[model samples]
Target: MGIDPKTIDWDSLGFNLIETRSMYKATCKKDDSWSPGELIPFGNIELSPAAGVLNYGQGVFEGMKAYRTLKNRIVLFRPEMNAKRISMSTKRLCIPEMDEELFLKAAIEIVKDNVDYIPPYGKGSLYLRPVVWGTGPVLGVKPADEYTFIIFASPVGPYFKGNIKPLHLKVTHNFHRAAPKGIGNAKAIGNYSASLYPSSLAKKTGFDEVIYLNAGNEQLIEEVGSANMFIVKDNVLKTPRLAGSILPGVTRDSVLTLAKEKLDIEVQETDVLLDEVCSADEVFCTGTAVVVTPVGKITSEDGEHSINDGKIGIITHELRSLLLGIQREECEDTLNWLHPID
Candidate 1:
């Protein structure tokens, strides 16, 4: 057993760890297949001091959420997309790839075991973090002999504290979120480490997050530090094309589909220039954590640009409402994105 639900202040939940009942785990060797994992009680596990993850940073993780819906039911949104993405990350990191079926099964089992930790409907959702790490010792810069896969969770609130109010972001050409020919698209642990300093600096200066430009071309916008970015220009919804450097967010894909089908908006996936984003009619971001949030202000060397007069754009509001409605079972899940836990 873990912390009692009665003690959890659901209304005050944030994106911090609230230890749950158990976590799923599996192991494998470099040349072997992944073992059938089991749910282990939440606690620390021993690891080698010279582990590859500790030394060379060989790890990949995926972020997804489980929601308690309006029908008093538990569900996941587009989990298969997460499964596939994790698989890609593992392969890129040299970790023995785990089967997607096993991944989904393990995810289900972990959530069910920690069901009580899930916040109540409309309060917040349980944040799921599935990670694969190179656990074996490594001396030279090479793949480890063994690996570990774990799926843990926490009860959390909105990623950005201000709620639906638009975000104030800083554009930084000084740092790039990913390399065009590197592990930027793999969700590798190191990719995030590269952004900590810049992101923290931006936050200290009163900005919510920093937007990175493409490594090869500073003229092109890549993505927000931890989320995908989008711009609305002249009624066209546009986002940076996935050119192997940017993360292909599940929420990003869902938003694109919804814009075209539900809202009848033309969508464009291609090169998005820095000038284009700073001058767009509206800007927003999407991820498991942020869901959908508009960019109200963008601060760069040139100056501060206010989007839609520093308010959440109309299109941004509609998209967020439609997506949340489906997540909460309030509207028709026309896309069949939600997978009921039961």
Candidate 2:
């Protein structure tokens, strides 16, 4: 009965203070070779005042999780996806490329070292964070000459607390998350920083989240601030196409794959029109943090439109269950998406 995982209330669980005493860290020089990766204490390290990340906002990070399955195995859902996305992020900011093999190894080792803190199958998960930052000290307006990669883990509960209900969204027309041919496609720190004000405004107006459509043209739905948007109509799953603006989420890809193979749903990845979304049967958002969120109602310039039953829809619930099954190691992993750590 010592901290029973199943009995632990995920909504009220906070970070436990037990130190893992281990972190995976490595440094890359100008020549692109990585220094020896080491497992060190989870403590702060000093950086130069003129660090490129401090001044130029040259930092990128990825959020992933490890779940203890019903089979008593620790598994990570689609970590390779995180590796690929972080590589793309490096390219976007002119940072040195990371060896995918090395990066993945570091991530896995960090989780393995802290496996005891990984909550039970359904209670919560061990949230994995892989961060890359420009480390060189430079006052000039150019790319940093060096960089550091670090991987850390912490136990986390469900991203959205309370019952898993459909969310309320406000269409943000006055702001844009990313411009065409801009850094919006990358998971950079600056992109999220720029969106804080608009997101705050949306929350103040009684909305659960904000969906930003393309600037000037309200017809094309780009994406939400932190997740990918999806609309269901007539048994079809539609999401915004990658038009050089949206972050391609790993959870979104997993849902599409599961829908096609398990649910037998027609998955469409294309340009979703804002007007068409108003008439969608149901809407949902996907991300690493929030596995899946049902959109209850959408508030736009015209008015609010109620989604399917103003609650979690049938298809949305089905998809969420299927995906969670795979993550929790309850279902047979037909797609081989889960990588077990022990």
Instruction: Give me the candidate number with maximum TM-score.
Output: 1
CA lDDT, every prediction? 0.91, 0.84
Per-residue C-alpha lDDT of model 2 across residues 1-342, encoded as one tens digit per residue: 123234445456554533444678898865576655888777777899999999999989888989888998999998999889988988888788777778788988989887777877677888887888999998998888889888877778766556886889999988999998888788898999989999999999888888899764679998876999999999999998887888989999999988899999999999899988889998999987878889999999999999886989888889898998889878899999999887
- Candidate 1 lDDT, 1-342, residue by residue in tens: 457777999878887888898999999889988768899988898999999999999999999999999999999999999999999988988888868999999999998998988888888898999999999998999999999999999999866555577889999978888888899888899999999999999999999999999999999998987999999999999999999999889999999999999999999999999999989999999988888989999998899998999999989999999998999999988788988997
**TM per model?**
0.98, 0.94
TM-score of 1: 0.98
Candidate 1 clashes: the total is 0
Off by over 4 Å in 1: 160-163
Please give the clash total of every predicted structure, in order.
0, 0
